[model samples]
Target: MLPREKYIQISLEINLFYQRIMKEHMLLIETHLPSVETALITEADSLKISMEQILSETVILANGNISEESIESHSIVTPFTLPCEEITSKLTGATINTNITMAELKLEAGTPSCTPWLEMEIDDINRRTLNLLDVIISYKKKLMEWVLNCKVFLMIYPEMLEHLIREARLYKRILNCLLDRKLPEFTLCEELDFWNNIMGEHAEFIDGMLDPTEKDLKEKARGFIARFERLVEECIKTAEKLIIQESLVATEDLRDYEIDATIGLLECKIRSVIPPILADHVLREAYHYILILNHK
Candidate 1:
């Protein structure tokens, strides 16, 4: 039987094996995630349109002698308030028809104006205003969600992927070396439980993206990526420990070669795998659906 260090070394090798699986998983997820910056920009543009609609409603309400009571009760958003004032000022002096002018005067004088034309216009404003307000409120909630999603995307993907890519190259080096030696003594246990666990996690991430019941892919993926990142960190630590411990048995110059070779292997692996993974249909579908939802 091999010495305990050799067994521990095998266990470490097994750990590195699973680390590569996780990197691939992360790559798949990164590939599938929607362009968050684009999504946020789209939402911001929609919110801007909603704000404009609210302002337009305000103008109609003011011009048509909408009651002070209605404006006070419904004008919860600040942007609508100043525009109401501006519309009143513009209508007070502008030469429209006599009826509309009287309605404007009556509105400024704080009396209810009841001309049917004015009343219908005011009614339309009320309906549209209420609807626009609801949209603005919903947009505010979405803004909060977007803030969180953007933070996760910014913090996680660049650093986490880079680490995983680096660690994976290192593992490939060790794998290649072990393979070259034709060492049959080192066997990953039959189950390859660690690899299975990572694949399970990958499946769950994909399921979240695909499940019709899931409301927001970015939100779900954000959580999964954060959790997966923690797991990757632990796996990288284990891999690095193995590399350091193993290097203690080698000459200084040889140790440097091992480290460089491992890094080079991971870089090569990432180049070969990532672009094709990103092009996969599952990832493309996720991006498509997310864009559709954002536009809606």
Candidate 2:
């Protein structure tokens, strides 16, 4: 067992580390992440709306020019007829050929070829579009692989640290009880040692949570949860034992002070001290953390 002063010092250091992690997590959520997500969503939505509107307009224009009615009429094509039926057949053919050639020339004159500059501009736009898509894909991957992973860890670790601190303080109180000659009923040497070992194991798990290079993290987290459940069970058993011991003390030959004192201590343990150490909130939070890990 560590000396009281040494334990207090270690507790203070761990708390400071926890504070730092909390600050970083706050900064990420409050400032950095939200701003980036908002900007990306806004820009992507605007671009999508604009492209959809343009596509709709293009479809409408195309339908107007190539309607079913126009297609049917165009399909009923026939050879041209000369106005003078009495004219020679050779003259009619020459006249028809001349008009057809003139029309073809006129059509050719009206059409324009694509300029080099326009082609270059289109190529540049395509290249930039591809680059932008690549960048967005890369960003998404990194956000998932790094940012989101880190966020889950950051969110979970501080909470884990908080529980560890509580357990540490609980252990310290148990140590105090061991040392104090007055409260022997609260002092079971073997039970205290067992709980201390559990606390130590929990401390090690917390250290792993804060570690950047821990392997098989989710597996370890599951193990921690199993151990935590056992710890809770042990704590409940301890509480039951304390209650039974106090209740079994026969009232015969006992002063009023002694009876009152016993009751007072029992009430304190059940109502106040034990509640904080073996909290429902902690269990719920630990389970919630596990869910988050599984989700990620």
Candidate 3:
């Protein structure tokens, strides 16, 4: 009974509704990552649609320019071959494929238009945004790697040490912040889950070393060191994964604590065990990294 235009509009609306649903559905279940699924079912439910869906797969061709929605699809990713005009004066020999890409994009050739157009430049804010993102996720992975190592340490060690616990808690927070989309340095939890599984391993190693027998104390110490190395490797691997996967963060992030006294205590202990120079280097690097992130 409605007018023709009304019927058409209704049909279009129905199609759009389906499109939105499909986009959401594709986003949630398609990735096949349980973490992503959990996020989709929880915090990201509202996002329903990913940035990719919102952006669409369509490449923007404006003012003889071409760009893809994803960085991986950019021409820079996969380059083709094109011929040069300098070498070949004849149009037959001249080709258009590779060289014309960035320098001279091939649009539907037409006379230059005088109509005004908006000009945007790639600048600092964009660069900083990307770099900050890289750093946050990078450090976040570092934190997780430590967590995994600590986890292994937990399974093997007899007890936890205060320092290991403290670092574990700090690292957990840094990861939570990354998820929450908070700047790399924020705090959400009341108590730090300080001390990692490695602390327990360290305690076990030291306890064994103090024992009169159980002669494998030196071997045990080496095992503890090897575990530490594994933990660091896990952290690095985690950072790389998060960056690649572009993992989401939780709502509340973590902040740094006033750990000057604790750090000093830790430094003293570390100096006693390791060379003064190595201890100093570790302390300085940690201090500088903290200051840099905190200032931002």
Candidate 4:
């Protein structure tokens, strides 16, 4: 079984990062829908608000409960997060919870021990997160089905909907393992396969969303797509430490690319339908994958 302190730290850190990501996913869906699709748009908005509320709770819980490593990982909130959110909210005319981001920025690492009260709070947060994941996962699937069946037209791709669902499912699995007081059961190769594929899909989305005139950026995105595809193949073939090292290098490169892209988007130097927050979103995920690969 995992130690109580470790569990509490991991749970809060995970929620702090992923709850924000999931809410941004909802924001993307909400913004991409046509004005005529009021019902779907409203549902997406409500879901986004729910996720933001949960994230706010997580920020409060995590203030002094998480590790210093997580704070330094740049996976929870990048330097770009605040500026990106500010710009994106203004551009999209959407209400983003910069307050939560501000709170997260103030979080300090605590002693490596969990009090009984803290443990109870972590348990409650975990339960709430799991329930929220269920709703969002089902909603993502519904959107996927609707898009596939041509019942609705969304500016977002069907594959993107599937990608969001996969992320939520991964978060669900991690939270469940925490709730069970056990470590996650994934092997190195399994972890590589999951995150490498996610990285590849992110590259694909960036490529597809970029303006046709931005040939250089598009080509760069395609290169990342191919690179991650090859990494995934290696993951399927072997679980060697070499693969982990190689993945780390590739992920670092990708993270740099994401950072540049995010900067470009924030500075109005990139042409795309991709929001600045989405750019920062993918950048954070790449950084998260890098941390996982390094730990492996």
TM-scores for candidates 1 onward, in order? 0.24, 0.20, 0.19, 0.97
For 19-135, candidate 4 gives per-residue lDDT tens digits of: 988999999999898899999999999999999998998888888788898999999999999999999889988889899888888889987456898898889989998998899
lDDT at residue 166 of model 4 (Cα atoms) = 91
Task: List where candidate 1 sits over 4 angstroms from the true fold.
Answer: 1-36, 64-110, 146-296
Q: Which candidate number would show the highest lDDT if scored against the true structure?
A: 4
Task: Please write out the lDDT profile of model 2 over residues 239-273, one tens digit for every residue.
Answer: 65553233222111111222232243333422222
The candidate that achieves the highest TM-score relative to the unseen native structure: 4
lDDT at 183, model 1? 31
List model 3 lDDT by residue over 1-296, tens digit each: 43333222222222222222222222222222244234423322333233223222111212222222212221111111111122121322212122223332332322222222311111122232234334333433443354467531222122323332343344434424333423243321111111113322433434343334434543444454454344334443455434222111100010011122124323342112221221222222223222223222
Query: Which 10 consecutive positions of candidate 4 have the poorest summed lDDT?
Result: 233-242
| Candidate order by decreasing lDDT | 4, 1, 2, 3
Give per-model CA RMSD.
28.7, 36.5, 22.1, 1.1
lDDT (Cα atoms) of all candidates against the true structure? 0.34, 0.30, 0.28, 0.90
* Clash counts for all predictions: 1, 0, 22, 0
